[model samples]
Target: MGEVGWNEWLSMMSSLAVVLVLLGATLFGLKKMGLSRTKDATKNLNVSEVHNLGPRQKLIVITINNEQVLLGVTPQAINRLGNWPEQEAVDDLNQSIDINQLEPDFESPSDSPGKFQQLMSQVAKRTAERKKH
Candidate 1:
């Protein structure tokens, strides 16, 4: 085998560093660009919300308790939130309700938040505030 030269080692290292830097830059650029194409949820979007988010955007529908709740913006509304307490509560609730027993032909939103429900809730909350005054 030929003698290993210091210049060759430096050259190899320099090329590797450049490649790594380029890869990192590309990855960073991609991440910064927001590759997640999923549109913001629709259930909770109000007229004002739409105005704030700009017009003509796709929205996702979410059902909570058989009721449809429109989560506002894409980045604003999260599907899976990190909540340890909620997880535990869900596990406990699961233990109480047996899935096999409550067989149903169709699934509906029982507690889902509809547009009216949101309005009503807001009104009720405002009423309570007025009462406190």
Candidate 2:
């Protein structure tokens, strides 16, 4: 509550700097250990769809090592629901089957970038092309 003197202000700022450095080091360590939630998801284990049964229960379809497996996840544990047939030549751009038909319980939208983002990128590309021309 009282006004801080010059020395006290410098001491407080130094302490804050130390705390921030330690926090940054801890976050870097966590990222290196693959514990950061913001870390990119595993390339081999890709989530194809998710069905939320309740607040705590969900059925997830994840493609692991080219095989899709249905998983039932709860607060307690995760169980295998079933296995899906292997897809052929499927990519982010090309999908043969309708994702909605695969799961009736929940509507699974495509994971491709949103239409607005795509349109903006296209506009930017055309503008750059026009500038170059």
Candidate 3:
């Protein structure tokens, strides 16, 4: 009985090893055939953003090969809406902002020149009043 049990245990281990080997080979084959998710396959393609427009519709921004693509996607289909060079998009964004507008004028009253400063001052006053009460 002891010898029989030892043989059965050895047989089960061998079968398990064979199954693991087959599984590993199958995974390797799938990866080589490009049917498995692999980093090399998507190294240059990136989904930058996704915005849901409805329950079944979305706007997707994807970057591929140094170009940005805008896609409109729904349950039924995916459509390319537009595309632009990534560098051109960066340049356009930089050109849209004026450096001078972002600088706060120090000579003016603390609250007069910038809305952010004014809002901060109002917040400070409210907090001071709250502390007094």
Candidate 4:
């Protein structure tokens, strides 16, 4: 700032100090008012009452082979099978027929390939090798 008369400088400084004090007081007041709502919200927060399970809910009740399973399932197990994208049920249905006879066939990644396609791949490899030479 440029040098001003002492009286003008003091007056300008006083005005600036007043503005800073007013701003601080307004901010403090807003924070004080906001605390009431914050306290009210805290009082209204939801609390899940996780207590002892009842008779039916205690067991995971799944019938695998005309018999019910008495073991309780974890939340992680339920979360894992929640989504069924693609033809996953088809996999279960496809394996249902040969469950006892060929259990090895199920869950195995298919390795079958067309004969002509394999021969074409070999020809392409030979052509690439000739180009390299």
Estimated TM-score per prediction? 0.31, 0.41, 0.42, 0.27
Task: Point out where model 1 deviates above 4 Å.
Answer: 36-133
Better of 1 and 3 by lDDT: 3
Q: What is the model-wide C-alpha lDDT for candidate 2?
A: 0.57
- Say which prediction, candidate 1 or candidate 4, comes out ahead on lDDT: 1
Residue-wise C-alpha lDDT for candidate 1, range 1-133, written one tens digit per residue? 9987999999999999999999999888977886545645554432211112223222233334333333333323323211123333333323332223433333342333343234333433443454455
lDDT for each of the candidates?
0.41, 0.57, 0.60, 0.38
Worst 10 residues of 3 by lDDT: 93-102
What TM-score does candidate 1 get on C-alpha atoms? Answer: 0.31
List, residue by residue over 58-83, the lDDT tens digit for candidate 3. 56778899998867665555767667
Best-first order by TM-score: 3, 2, 1, 4
**Model 2 weakest 10-residue run by lDDT:** 104-113
**What lDDT is reached at residue 111 by model 1?**
30
- The superposed Cα distance between candidate 3 and the true structure at residue 86, in angstroms, equals 0.6
71: Cα error in model 2, Å = 1.0
Model 4: weakest 10-residue lDDT segment is 76-85
In model 4, where do residues sit more than 4 Å from their true spots?
A: 1-3, 35-133
lDDT of 2 by residue, 1-133 (tens): 8988999999999999999999999999998888966666656777887766446656667888888776666665576645645563243214322323332322322222242233323433443454455
